[model samples]
Target: MMVKQYLNDLVSLFFPQTCAGCDVPLAYGEQLICTACWFHLPYTYAHLDSENASARQFWGRVKLEAAASYLYFKEASRVQQIIYHFKYKSRPELGLILGERYGELLKESPPFNRADVIVPVPLHPAKLRKRGYNQSALFAEGLCRAMQIPVAALCLARVKATRSQTQVNRYARHENMLEAFEIRDPEIIGGKHVLLADDVLTTGATIEACASVLLDAGAAKVSAVTIAKAL
Candidate 1:
């Protein structure tokens, strides 16, 4: 038994599993990120501040109960590295890990703790087919695990694959995505405080497009959450 333990320790030393954010060697209980990196993660905490930029984005476009993003994403930041791994490197588990951590922080905030159900922004069928998974849904699942909330997967639908909003102005994005989303089932969300989740928030165009549909379908109110907010 001692030999087995010794061998395990020797192998761990050679591999020296490290944190994604800080590259510190992880302890036995740690996963992708180490304790230092996890605790020192750069968080946005937008949910704690009602007038944050995240909520302000939907000022006249839609009524949001609250809005927040977990992290601030810059070009070469640690948050960006983690996001890149989760979104593009086939690491679905990373999405779940991030969601759980972020969700815990969100629960301490006012509006988030009262969410009726979580709904991830739906990806277009074509995109889902190509990616083989919805990254936002993975994040939502992680959130649900942390918050003990149910996820309403069918509450929103992506009706069209609109052009990328990155190259367009806010006005152009809204115009282009005007008819991009639809609500398939109003019964699930009627009079409910819905938490709309996504992997990232850039211009908030996609969230707005989907929120408009949910509101039209009788959602009492809509709030937004994302793993990161692109700055």
Candidate 2:
């Protein structure tokens, strides 16, 4: 064991892990994010407020039981940079880390504590094959780790491959996602309050699209949470 620890330490000394938020070399016992950077992250505390901006996004459009985000994302900010890494840089573990941390907080919040299961937004089969992993599913896995709840990973399906959301306005994004999602297994969501998981809350069109189908499938209610929110 001592020899193994020595070899691992030698390897880490040459290629150290760094914090995702600030790109600083992490210290012992630190994970993806360093303690200081984690403490300084722009947390939204959306879990504490029902009428928060993220929840308010679906006010007149969708009947979400609740919606919340963990961090505030702004262009060129640390949150945005980290999120870019999370989605595009093959750092899917970041999703799990953030989700687990958020789940710890969600356990204390009324709206989310009632959520019986977590259902991550799905990726179309082609995209899932290309990406090799779904960021939202990884996030849900992490949340399940911390929340001690089940993740119904195959409960929903993204049937249509819509245009890149970044290329469209909010209305167009919603239209693009309409009928794009379907419940793969209604029994998984039936009569259960679902906590919908995603990497970020942008225009919220995708969440709106996914939540509608889950509710129609007999989910008691749907609540949404994400790693960050674009304001």
Candidate 3:
């Protein structure tokens, strides 16, 4: 036990834990984030507006009740660092932390407060196996805990993995994601309001695909929430 404690102390000394966003020294018991940076994180509060910019991204293509993101992701902003840690570093708790923290504000927003279920954009099985966990699902779990809503993990399933949407143009977004997702259970989501969760909204291709599947399965309404908006 003493040897283990010494090893832990050595690791802490070498790593010298700092906030992922601001590089500030973390206090005792703090994880990869710090309290100061956490409070200063930018929030859009777009869900409260009927025609927020994030929701307007899907204007003619898809229908949604409301949508919002917790942060605005700029190229080199702290939000990018947070997302980087959550996405590529295997620190999924960052996603949940942001979701749970954002959930408080979301619960007070109109329409969002009434969502019956939370559905996370599904990752293909191969990708999920490689990543060990899905960031969107982790975010949804946190939102579910904060809102007291149930999380529908497999409501949407990816039929197959596709090439990255980044290299594709605007016109190819929909086609690139064609038949990528399908509803696993229609009965549960039929006629129910759903709050779709994802890590980021970049061109809205993946969300659109997932939303299409859910709507086809008879979901009464579909709204979206994400950690950041990449616009």
User: Considering every candidate listed, which one attains the maximal lDDT?
Assistant: 2
Q: Model 2: per-residue lDDT, tens digit, 88-170?
A: 88899999888888989998888798889999999999989988899999999988998888999999999998878888877
Q: Candidate 1: count the clashes.
A: 0
Local accuracy of candidate 1 as per-residue lDDT tens digits, 40-114 = 677877878999988887899878888888888888878887887777767788888988987888777778889
Error of 2 at 26 (Å): 1.1
Report the Cα lDDT for residue 86, model 2.
Answer: 85
Report lDDT per candidate: 0.85, 0.90, 0.86
lDDT of 3 by residue, 94-118 (tens): 8788888878888888788899999
Cα RMSD to native, each candidate? 2.6, 1.7, 2.5
Order of models, best TM-score first = 2, 3, 1
Model number with the top TM-score: 2
* Superposition TM-score, candidate 2 onto the true structure: 0.94
Location of the lowest summed lDDT over 10 successive residues in candidate 1: 16-25
- What count of clashes does model 3 give? 0
